[model samples]
Target: MTSLDMTREALARAERESAMKSRILATVSHDIRTPLSGIAGMSHLLGQTRLTPEQANYLAGIGQSVQALSQLVDDLLDFSAIEAGRFKLHPRDDDLRQLIESVVEILAHRAHEKGIEIASWVAADVPGLLSFDPERLRQVLFNLVGNAVKFTNEGGVLVSASMVEGELEIRVRDTGPGMSVRGQERLFREFEQVGEEKSRIGGTGLGLAISRRIVLEAGGSIAVESELGVGSTFVVRVPVGQPSDFRLRQARATMLSSTHMLIIAPDGVCREALAAAVTSLGGTVRLAATPADLLASLEHAADAFTDIVVDRRLADFLSEELCKHPVFRNPATRRILLIDPETRSTTRFLGAGYDSWLVRPLRERSLVGVLQGRMKGIELRDPINDNRSNSRWTQAEGSGLDVLLAEDDPVNRLLLKTVLKKGGHRVSEVETLRDLIAAATQATGRPGAIVTDLSMPGGNGLDALSAIRDFERTNRLAEVPIIVVTGSAGSETRKAAIDAGATELFVKPADPAKLAELLASYAARRAG
Candidate 1:
């Protein structure tokens, strides 16, 4: 063969090897997660039962262990996929503020346990809906924040994201013991751990390595800055891909133009974030470091401020005193509290003369809406507990629909069935592709929804989905929502499933809570 022919053959061989590795990894991942899902599902069910404190601790331990194991498995598979050139990015349009808040929420428990605060903020200029892979981006944030929380003992961690130039810049700053120059140099190396107390902090040490690779693959850069006695900050900048439907909505949302506000935030970081948000929306703002400062500013200023935004910590200190003040007593001036996420209730604020509240690491949209009196305080409710009384869920549960579930594994099938039953749905179980197609096409009445696994004994689930879709079209029947819960992690598998008419695809082991929520939504949609 010629040199060019030889090179082509080599390239083809490498592609084939990568494809083979991808298939093997998918099978392995699915097999491992299938059983993990069973454990997780049973754990969820077990927690719902009444138990002693000791039993609850044990159950919690099991959950933590399972989560750790799952993370390990995922990390190993993700590294292998990256090495084999099989890693893929799934980008979608989602709110940047929501993404940052989610990361903080996930790590809030850990930070609280350590007696430290964790918060995030997104600049007003950042578009609400940015095209990015949330899952992958979140993974990087998790590693950065998780490490920061693990090391920091006294101070807190603050994460902020902004649109700088044409890139999205994410900054994760932690008040932990600073790292040495050598430690920073070796930070991104695979399986290398370096820090002041490396011995005390236990991890696979693959997080930063994987994160670096992910960022580089996405045409982004990750860097760090630290000093011996000071803390550290990890900054990641990625190219921002605007969605096809992108618009400068935030720039156009100047409804707060006529609003004048007095802001009081003791925390400098939070105060600046709030001020930026307000001004970005065309509102005028004056900052105060304390209640006295706020009072002094109000007393001297000739302008009648339309709004008063104060942090809950400061408000708690002098709520009564501030409420009695002449300027504070002005009924027209809206009082907005910057509440910490852990504040379980808002009733105390009402009694303290506050009219509205906004959660910290404030989003620009929420800030604008609250200033314009177009939005209400966001109430943090427990989803599982609230579902019992939620009108939508109640309506769906009161008159459940027939749900068809397809899974070759008995354990997964049983787990899914239990979850569906708990949601008040009647389920018909099928194990093979042939049976899935038959049950789906031949049912006397249309199923409320169908949940299936991609890999089946008799045939491929995608093929079954295709056949079912054809039958539905041919018979002029309404299309049923088919949710795919599989172990496959290949992008090709996800693409094929979507192309074959899958409504939603979840990789195993799917959270029982999320799966149930998805089912409930479909039922509710149909009922509506």
Candidate 2:
């Protein structure tokens, strides 16, 4: 055979092999990721269970390892998809403000843990709604922000967006060791790392390459500006336009429309508490304790229900069944899964099907925000009661009382429990709402007060609080004080807790001394 023919044959063979490799990697990565996600999630859930300090640390390490594995698999798949031109933009109207804020909130904790500050600013003039695929935008932003936080040591990261010539220009800037000229050239090239030295950071090195492809596919361009030993700024520019639904929604804003919500769970306490919370926000909530109950509820008001929230486990069983149902056929209705943050397995399970997942420990504000974000037509009533504001109580300590507490966040929950227990009062602790309810109800003596986190697995603290109140009302015991502990403080949440018979609402990271004083006052009142 001629040399020219042999060279052509070799080139064709190489192209075919490359294509086959991409497909193999894609399939293997996808399959591996499904199980790996479950492993990572389960590890997280295991960490939340009762463990010794050492055991807890070990579980945390396992969780981190699984997360790293998941990221590696995801990067491999993303790179393969980009190379094959399978990565495409899926654009939809998105709330830019909400999208950016959510990303920042999700990443801020990790950045802070690394001693890096992450901040975001959105120009007020930015449209409330813009045409973009939020998922792709989020993925690109995640890559940029992740790299910034990973490389930075002592300095901070800033994310901000502004309008420029009918386009939105988003920037992620980091105070980290800058890249060299060669590094910049290889940054957006496939499978290229900054340095061959083992001392540098680790990654699949395809993130920036994939990010560039995603940005370009979305009708935008991405560029980087960096200085060695100074920092780096990655910018993305995408065209901005008012969303079609935004205009129609604005026109209909004057008309009062009632939104129907469905809460699917086996526990009555969680069902009732969520119902009350939704009701407080001017939404009518339908509680369904079982799949049969949910189907029945949907039958009665198939067209009326606008949103659905189900526990992750229950959602797993119902999603396929529910999707086949006539009620869920409507594309307008939103489906959300209420998930246990510690139960990473549940997260992976829910991720397979649900529109979104609401992490357990649902504060009133977050719940309201989620609902509002989903049901754009429903106007939320302000939950805060400014008319009854008490400046004196702002700094006043909580009433002193022997309390039974149920919470999942170890640091915050333990800190609060310690402060209350040290204040010459008895304090019993449990991790889940189910345990809290069982212990509180089965106790030989009544607790002077019950303190609980609003979100917990099995059920939320709000559920426990409602159950306690219902038991007291049914048994005719003297009204026991209850305090709702939450991470977010909003008037709406406070009102909902009070309406559900809670005595007070306490935000996390609250002053220990002030909480102790409040507990003392409440204890004195009960004694009196």
Candidate 3:
């Protein structure tokens, strides 16, 4: 009780707290910086020149390194936020149906790659409108779904939701190596894993911990059930109504049975491609090469069309008019403006009351994702072959080959070039879609497979693929294989690239070794 005794005890406590803070910061920095360094270094290496096919693959492996590192960093940040009780919830009225669809769309590609099918079933009994934070819900679900996909080596991940006694119950089930009793008990503890195998799989092990915190904060509860070597299921239950909660009415309110899509572009090829992609997605697409034709079409079908999608160049000419027009002013109709990456100005479109902004070459998946997000009831069918139950291609050894590299980022281009070159493949580089076409046409002299980025200025990888297909149709080029590379492997983007004629899709920061193996396989196929 003495003043001296109190001061001594207080000093010790402060010192202990400071030391713990220092330790935490050091661990986080190491965890975050490791993968970031790999991403930057490998990306830089890939941009170099004169790379062999094998070397190019080594650079691809760098991307996987970055992803693993990024996940760890995110887990740490989320854990910290939860522990501080500083994590805030911004709840809004959301359509649970749409939210589940969005999560499925995001994770579909990864599941497909693993030969796993993901099916979602939302119970009709569950209320369409619920009060919750969309982003937080997405984050929580993403962690669960992502874990399901990552841990499962066979079967698939299924997400289903229903209402049970006034509570919304969302379940994520996966057929993978299941957890043990001890694993289940420690699942929600920070920096903890069930076993050695899990630690090697590269998780910071904070996903379940963060999920528990978020669910609890939202007045919800989460539980897990699993059996060894069979599968696991995670269930989240949250109450449906609270007086302060905001409710999002069903998307069916704005649903359209038929949709009209207008693609306005100066280039005929680009216009046709956009039209085709839209049509493939169950929309009636109209191509307008000029502003006059576009305007005429809009005016003629003012009431018939449910939505209007226009190129950025054409958007400028029609934005003001569309906003003031009686048809667009109606709440039922929606407008989406498409901009080329080169056009950075968003001021004009925002002023015109456009519902969304899209950038070219507008991957089909992204477009559909945006549409599905904006519209309430339009359902999107699975793009992958669900019946195909084959496992991923086995890892292969390097077979010296030639590679055609197409990318816009100077750093990424150089990095890929370096890696491929080191792997012992002859590498040629191109920056634009036009150049890619030219290179493919001239491939007879230096025949090889193509590796291209999805997004590029002055045309893109998909455009180049279309041109290559045309050349093949005319017998001007051989049936050379192509790989599409991208940053965000959204379900829509992957499906779009594949539908556009890519042989395989690789997400950014991919493993270089895997890229090399793919190239080697292409070479073997060409020889066979």
Clash counts per candidate, in order, are 0, 19, 36
Top TM-score model:
1
Q: What are the per-residue Cα lDDT tens digits for candidate 2 across 384-432?
A: 1112222332222333455887776665565666567556667778888
TM-score of 1: 0.84
- Please list the residue runs of candidate 3 whose C-alpha ends up more than 4 Å from where it truly belongs after superposition: 1-60, 195-199, 240-528
All candidates: CA RMSD in angstroms?
Answer: 4.0, 24.6, 21.5
Best lDDT goes to which candidate?
1
Model 2, position 477: C-alpha lDDT score: 78
TM-scores for candidates 1 onward, in order: 0.84, 0.45, 0.43
Write one digit per residue (lDDT tens) for candidate 3, span 53-119: 5654565455456656666655665565555444677788887767876777656656656656555
Better structure of 1 and 3 per lDDT: 1
Q: Give the least accurate 10-residue stretch of model 1, judged by summed lDDT.
A: 383-392
12-119 per-residue lDDT for model 1 (tens digits): 998898878766876677789888878876877677667777886687677766776677677778887888876878888877788787777777666766777677
lDDT of candidates 1 onward, in order: 0.79, 0.66, 0.66
User: What's the lDDT for candidate 1?
Assistant: 0.79
Considering TM-score, where higher is better, how would the candidates rank from best to worst? Answer: 1, 2, 3
| Residue pairs that clash (backbone atoms under 3 angstroms), model 1 | none
